[model samples]
Target: MQDTIRRNGSWLRAAGIVVAAVAVSAGTTLPAAADTDSWSYLTKMQAHEMWKIADGSGVTVAVIDSGVKDGSGWKIDSVLPGVSYIEPPFERPDYVYPPHDDFVGHGTTMTAAIVGDGSSGGPKGLAPGAKVLPIRTSVGTPMAFAVASEAAKGIRYAADNGAKIINLSLGWTPDWPMDKVKPAVEYAQSKGLLIFAAMGNEGEGKNWTNAIAGLPGVIGVGAVDPTGKAMPFSSHGPDTDLTSVGSKVEIRCAENKGWCTGNGGTSFATSLASASAALVWSAHPDWTANQVARVLIQTAGAPTDGSKRSDWVGYGVARPRKVLLDHEGDPGAPDVDPLAAPAAPKTPAPGTDPTAAAAAPRAEAADAESGLSWQWPALGAVAAVGLGLAATVIVKRRRS
Candidate 1:
């Protein structure tokens, strides 16, 4: 049966599912550091200076996206065994769904932005001491319902495992109802997982609302440029809870095909937000999800217009430097959620003892920075999958 994804009540063009990578070669030349750049705002915030205090050690961020590429020079220190929900084309005998295999390259960029080691000339991650749990889902297809369901499964799986933070650098069109994945997000929060999601990239004129970012307790992140202005392309809505430098960012593509630059999107901003949380959570391993979120909100750059929060920049830009370097903000009560989402009763998973003790935070040393150079490629358009008939997806852009 053919799965069709519709947009604006009309069936859009569909394409054949791309083949999953059984094994990818790692011989492509990486981009040079001198030729590429990172988030200029992060540099101004002195993220490197803050790293001395905490580099996201003892934290695990679940990256639920198209897929993440695992290999040398990828800046990933450790990638845990992850799950995949991508259906094979025709159930071929040679089909193998590798969770870490990234064909779209979007997930790879998101991962590198969070924990990339900066060894292969790629951008240094904000949380270099953290581990990544890759949760691969269906993308590039037209079945929005299937895609959303897979993403929900990924969230639950990450929460049950050891993910302290979840990065959802993906979203659907404005009209796509988020009910399918909303419960899973709540379940993750109930389990003490902090989720950061993109607010979409429809810009000011066509600024569409993304409910995933607006979900209670989910940190909805938007994009801002160097001058503390919301990017014209950044989605704006009541759910917008935070902002990050989303313009002119650097990223590492799969297949060793060097680095790419001139990229901007809520997806990248979400990754940065996740990394910021990791840094705080690692420094204070015992803090509950709510406390960490409260601190992040309290320490974030406030709106330049003197407002507490806004539809465009949320609580201003995410600034971990204050929390790490200056020790600003209060973690607040551990039991209270900062985003104001009511806590759901925790339910034990099947076959698991409810009395089992929660696992202790992992203790890992931050990796040393490497001198290998890398570059960022121009953002390119790729196929995005989602559910419902009234939604449309913004093409992932590449600036070459």
Candidate 2:
């Protein structure tokens, strides 16, 4: 049935869906303390930096996953009415039929990672002041053709509805191609939307090229551990644009179950990266998407390749504070893309094969200064303060 649905014209060209299915014989359990510890570190650093930038305050992030649970300790003051794209055979009339009803906690977890305020000692988000627009798709099911169609619809809806950042934590392997998904992504980008996506968690498996992550304009984020090392399970390659703390991040687990302890993957990492962009965007309202992106790439932590970049870490871990504090950084020419080097080739259009195009040889590994790395130290020290005193300490540190 799903294959038949994909045969449709125009829609058949969408990106492939790369879903990672971990064994779930055991029921989902609450995350352990170690997970909470990691989340505290990431969010605490975000707060201490005081990155209330112009990139994301008035911005709206459309979270496309399972539905979000409203009272999950996040400061989500407004949510545009959302719709459910999960094709239904089993129906519940009591449930408002569409938005904010999360049977599976994935979407809610992503939301908290982006805009949560740490009201109940849970994880604090990078962009606490931004708004969220929830769009529910699927949970525990394969990436059905109908679901992909619905996701495209959701992306279009988000763009039409005025969302500035679209965060997609979902992926599938046997799915649509770029031709189908490109229109939707282009539409959103045309509206000045910043699309952020997970690089997939199949690092332990084939570790195939992630679809959305590989898309030309989209920003792909990878996960890093508390110690600043890439997680063994984190997907790698030049496709990754930035890194964020993802290992052992804690979030609301399930109904009445309190918070879970093991929230690790590119799924959560992408959300944090989006929130980081939001903080910078919120602070600099005048900057365009390209300008904002350029700031991030330019100010990111040095890569492993020294002078150049590693295919695994790209420009390296994202550091929003570097952009926030650097009064002299150039946002770059408004028309140029930040990801592309001055001489990098333009992306090929639909029906044009990219592999056939001649490209520059990879540059020699460059040497970079290995001074005190900022992201890890900031995260480690903040987590040490514990969540109970996070707000007070964060405020005091920012002032000082």
Task: List per-prediction Cα lDDT, in the order shown.
Answer: 0.64, 0.57
Candidate RMSDs in Å, in order, are: 13.3, 12.5
lDDT (Cα, tens digit) per residue for candidate 2, span 1-400: 3433343221212111111112132234344443345455554355655653333578788987767877776755745567677664333323332678664456777787777776664566677778889988753233333445666778888899878789877654443334545678778888888888776554534454356666666777766665556654455555677766665666544331345656346777778778877877788777888787777766766555474444445566677766675553578787666665532433546776433312312221112111001111111112110001011110100000
Candidate 1 lDDT by residue in tens digits, 105-157: 56777778888776655566778788889998765434434567788899999
Strongest candidate by TM-score: 1
Give the distance in Å from residue 97's predicted Cα in candidate 2 to where it truly belongs.
Answer: 3.8
Error of 1 at 245 (Å): 0.8
Model 1 — which ten-residue stretch has the worst lDDT? 364-373
- Cα-based TM-score, every candidate: 0.76, 0.73
